[model samples]
Target: SQKIEQNSEALNIQEGKTATLTCNYTNYSPAYLQWYRQDPGRGPVFLLLIRENEKEKRKERLKVTFDTTLKQSLFHITASQPADSATYLCALATFIQAGTALIFGKGTTLSVSS
Candidate 1:
């Protein structure tokens, strides 16, 4: 079955360290890729978006890459802080005649500690 997969386990890291998260998909061609951060009790917030034709995207301390050939995307947080801890989700969007369809991974929880 076509699916998007992210690490189900939580990633633990110390403050000031870099945290890397992986998102892999099978049997899907997405036009745009997006990363989002969700807090414990809040909706997910948009982080970065990369086009299938683009290799990477960055903003502040966040970086994301899309490799259609490899069917994967990597999300990174540089100099991560405790406040940066959250559940990160990868979303794939494909434009359809109806409009746009979005598929999201289960998300990988990140825990940054002091």
Candidate 2:
């Protein structure tokens, strides 16, 4: 069986520092991986997507690295601030009825203290 796990607790960090989070999984090789950010009571917004053939992907203050051998993904936010506080989700692509759906882990809440 395939499984994905993200940090179930919140991560608190001071403003202007880099925030790092982890996503671990087992038993499957996905076609791609995606990261999303969700604010309170809202749907997650897509951030980055990395294919299995890729090593890393980045956007603005965010960077993501995927390691298929270890079946893990690392997400980072540099120069973080209070406005950056949100829950980050990691999802892997799974095929369903000729379309793709993301298999998401429970998400890690990040609180950036100013």
Candidate 3:
């Protein structure tokens, strides 16, 4: 079976700073990984996805890196603002006989302060 883990503690950062989050997995190979942001009451919103063949991907102020060797993915938010505060989730997809299986981490909550 595969397992995913993220920071158990909440991440605190200041506005205008860069925030880095980590996602680690074990015992499985994923074809791609995705990041999502979930507010208190809203569903998760897709942020980024990086394929196994890709080393890094970026969009606007967000960046994601996939390292198959390390079985890890790093998520970064540059020029973070208080509005960016939310629970960030890490998910991985693997193709199976039935379909694609998506596994999600517990997520790391981020709080940006002025």
Best by lDDT: 3
For candidate 1, the per-residue lDDT at 11 reads: 97
- TM-score of predicted model 1? 0.91
lDDT of each residue in 1-114, candidate 2, tens digit only: 468899566899999999999998886778789999999999999999998899999899999999999899999999999999999999997667878776898999999998
Worst 10 residues of 3 by lDDT: 92-101
Which has the greatest TM-score?
A: 3
Give the distance in Å from residue 49's predicted Cα in candidate 2 to where it truly belongs. Answer: 0.3
Candidate 3 lDDT over residue span 1-114, tens digit each: 678999665999999999999999996669889999999999999999899999999999999999999999999999999999999999987556798788799999999999
State every prediction's TM-score relative to the real structure.
0.91, 0.91, 0.93
Off by over 4 Å in 1: 94-99
Of the candidates numbered 1 and 2, which has the greater TM-score value? 2
Tell me how far the alpha carbon of residue 21 in candidate 2 is from the true structure, in angstroms, after superposition: 0.8
Q: What ranges in model 3 sit over 4 Å off?
A: 94-97
